[model samples]
Target: MYFVYDIGGTFIKFALMENNGNIKMKDKFPTTAKSAEELVAQMVEKFLPYKKAVKGIAVSCPGVVDSEKGVIYQGGSLLFMHEKNLAEMLARECHVPVVLQNDAKSAALAELWLGVAKDVHSATILTLGSGVGGGIIMDGKLQSGYHLMAGEVSYMESDFDTEKLRGEFFGRTGSAVELIKRIATKKNLTDKKDGEQVFALIAHGDEEANAIFNDYIYGLAVQILNIQYLIDPEIIAIGGGISAQPIVVERLNEAVAQIKAANPFHAAKPNIVTCRFQNDANLYGALYNFFIQFADEVI
Candidate 1:
């Protein structure tokens, strides 16, 4: 068995996986604020019970991670810094090998190994939540650029305004709790409780909901178009909470069709689909990373 941890801003999800890629047990905890050393100490305390059963550990983190060196250059939405060597700290505490990967890259690895991108040689996966995230795979390998920040599509310039698109959006909606605030504020409608409530309003055919959905789809389509022009992968998988909404997918497709019609490119458009693994993709990917790194000794 192997232990996997998917670390995020709000929560840290942990799981134990069998040799056959099945989760045996899983749990989650709120991610409290702490220094690098303190955080590692907390993780070691939480992971002690599973140490004897598992051979090694694999972690998926949201930031610029150096997979090979086990260093995190940045901890987006988390309380970490550039100099922290998370994997190294974990390895020291547990006396086992520790592997680390970007959360989006881990999700892509999961899809490539067992989910939608299983048969594809190249693909891109995008996660849209509080902010957009992405991963790129080429020739059956994850592509981390020179700085280990290749598939970080969120920071990509969507407008010539010099400010990042995500920064602008995130400024309005502080957390996932506030996504509806931006939607309601922009459309001059009363703020809903959450994203699901916004969807409910859309279901009722509210004009404000419709307009918000349309604008969201257009923004997403613009990013998709940028990705299309850059890597032009064989497939593009969209994941995150929004992916569960079929209306969002339909509107995104419509916008894509419009863009394709305007462009005269003879190249084949990338196949866009929803992620099959949903919220568990990162955890599964962490397990996959553990298996790949410790395959010989794991069994």
Candidate 2:
């Protein structure tokens, strides 16, 4: 079995799985460490529990990852990971072959290899969580772009002026956090609540909640429409924590219908679906990376 890790800003999700995408064990822990040393130590401890059975380590990291060099140029949320040779460092400590992949690209790889996009020629995944993350596949290949920033949809700017503020990119405008914040503010909730709580209010058909929810879904629809115009993929998959909610897919489709009806020039109706892997996409994708890297070897 190979160990795979999906390294995020606030948590590290790890799993042990075979090359066939069958997971044997999986768990996650908070990413409290801020520095490289602490981060390495944390990973080392996690690996210690499954050391003997693990043959290699594959990481799905959030950054401008140079998979060829096993280095991260710019860590998205973990600034300390910048300029770090993560695969090498972790390999030295864990004593295993290591490979690294950008988180978004990994998700796309997962879909192409064994998930929803497996039978499709080209597909894209737009992850709506704290921000808008994405992965694109074209002609059965992942498009990393010239700067290895092909799928960084979080940086995409909306047509509206709200995204002009510093750090207020499309991610801030079209994301679950934004939706929850809108609902919380509208409902005058004192304590901060998560997307689930806010969604519950929307389910109850609260007037203010419905308004906020509709606006949020509309914002996401705009982004999806923009994606269709640009990439024109065969299908687009919506992934992230919120996508697990059945209402999210229903609402997004409704918004898409509205947008399409409003525009006569837009003839393309890109097929959109919810991601199948959900939270475990990165993990399965990371294992796929490991599999491809060692294709000559039998596991």
Candidate 3:
């Protein structure tokens, strides 16, 4: 058996799974640590009970990760993790070998291993949640650029004229969560009436909802087009809570079409599709990473 962890901004999701990626058990807890040392300690405390039962641990975390070195160059939300060798830290405490990969890259790995991008020569996996994050697979292998930050589409600047939004990261503007919050605030709603209510308004042709949603879609379309010009991947997979909605693909494609209309530079179009995995992708991906790294010992 193997233990896999998907470390997110808000929670750390851990799982026990077989070598074949079948999860036997899973759970999550708030990620409240303020520093890397504390974060490592927190995770260690959680897995201690199962430490003896598993052969190895695989972690999917945010930031620019050097998988080969087991080091995090920069942390996205877990800012304290920058420069931390989490794998070494975990191994030292539990004395079990650990492998670490960037969270977005792990999701993409899951898709490439057994999901949508399977057997594809090239593809991009975009995880759109609170903020945008994703990974790229080129030549049938994941590409972690020199800085280990390839496919970080979220970091790109969004061209917006509004003073508040001007120069904002596309990751923030292209977020479904943000769109929901924007609509909820405008519609005077509570948490319970957030995502569904927002989508419902758009579905009912509420002009304000449609305008806000269109802005979000426009940002996405520009980036998707940029990606097409850059790598021309066969498929761009979008994974997140919002991707579950069929309208997201449909609306995004419509936005892409609007942008491509009579635009000479827009020669090749993007082939966008929803990812096979969603919220649980990182868990499966971490398991797959473990399977590949600790094959001899794990299997």
lDDT of 2 by residue, 1-299 (tens): 88889999889998888867788988889989889889989988989989999889999988898887899987989989999999999999999999999987888888878888888888989888778889998887778888889999989876646555544478788777777887888788874556777878889888889987887788888888889888999999988888888898888888888888998777768788988877888887777777777786434
lDDT of 1 by residue, 8-27 (tens): 88888888888667999989
Using lDDT, rank the candidates from best to worst.
3, 2, 1
What are the C-alpha RMSDs, in order, of all predicted structures? 3.3, 2.3, 2.5
Please give the CA lDDT of all the candidate structures: 0.77, 0.85, 0.86
Clashes by residue pair, model 3: none
Which candidate has the highest lDDT of all?
3
lDDT assessment of candidate 1: 0.77
Error at 247, model 3, angstroms: 0.6
Winner on TM-score between 1 and 2 is 2
Rate residue 273 of model 1 by lDDT: 87
Runs of candidate 3 exceeding 4 Å displacement: 160-166, 295-299
Who is ahead in TM-score, 1 or 3?
Answer: 3
Over the stretch 95-157, how does candidate 3's per-residue lDDT look in tens digits?
888999988889998998889998888999988888888789898788888877798878888
